[model samples]
Target: MAATVAQPTHMTRAKHWNEEVENAYRFQLAGWRDQVEYTGHKGEVTTWPNGLIKKLMRKSDECWYYFNKTRECADKDINKCKLYTY
Candidate 1:
């Protein structure tokens, strides 16, 4: 039997820049709702030594989206990213 994948039950637009927002920004930028959905599609994710995501392969094109250890979401993008809660 195939394993079941986890998914988000709730989502909301991010209002500030924090750890959670940073994670959501990366997943959303790669065209997903959050890590749960990303992992559901990609299997697993890569992360940096600091525990931040290192990169993500976009499902639509299979291209990679690399992330810095620091924040990547700009002031303009903060409001555009949707944070998910399960």
Candidate 2:
């Protein structure tokens, strides 16, 4: 007789972002870039873009502020932005 194998009843799934979440983040980044260009002083114009880019890269991982409160709407859906999705 062949031995029978049992499969686990529960499975873990990975979360991912849908098009909406992606577009929101992209729009936020673009707005930040625009702000870097429009708000910086004349002397700081050349350097501010680099600084803003670094800041955006670093802060992009922050869940609370990344989507700028849009996370709430995405909270209910796994395909939307969530803890690990970003």
Candidate 3:
């Protein structure tokens, strides 16, 4: 049997800059709803030395979206991101 994956209980829009918000932005930019969805389609995610996402391949056309070690989600994007919590 396959392992059971827990779905997020609720989601909220990001109002500040944080790791969760940053990750949400990356996944959204890569055209995925979230990491769970990304992993379902792409398997695994790669990260930088400091634990930030290094890159993500877009599922739409197999293009890649690279990210810097620093935070990529700025103040402007905080409001645009939705964070899921289990």
By TM-score, who's the top model here? 3
> What TM-score goes with each of the models?
0.84, 0.20, 0.85
Judged by whole-model lDDT over C-alpha atoms, candidate 2 comes out at 0.32
Q: How much is 55 displaced in model 2, in angstroms?
A: 21
- The order of the candidates by TM-score, greatest first, is 3, 1, 2
Across residues 4-53, which tens digit of lDDT does each residue of candidate 1 receive? 66766887888988888888888888887788877776778898877778
Alpha carbon lDDT of residue 71, candidate 1?
A: 78
Displacement of residue 27 (Cα, Å) in model 2 is 0.3
Candidate 3's TM-score: 0.85
Worst 10 residues of 3 by lDDT: 1-10
Cα lDDT over the full model 1: 0.83
lDDT agreement with native, every candidate: 0.83, 0.32, 0.86
lDDT tens digits by residue: candidate 2, 1-86: 22332333433332665544443333344343232322331112222222222222222443322333223234345443212220
**Poorest 10 consecutive residues of model 1 by lDDT?**
1-10
Decide which is better by TM-score, 1 or 3.
3
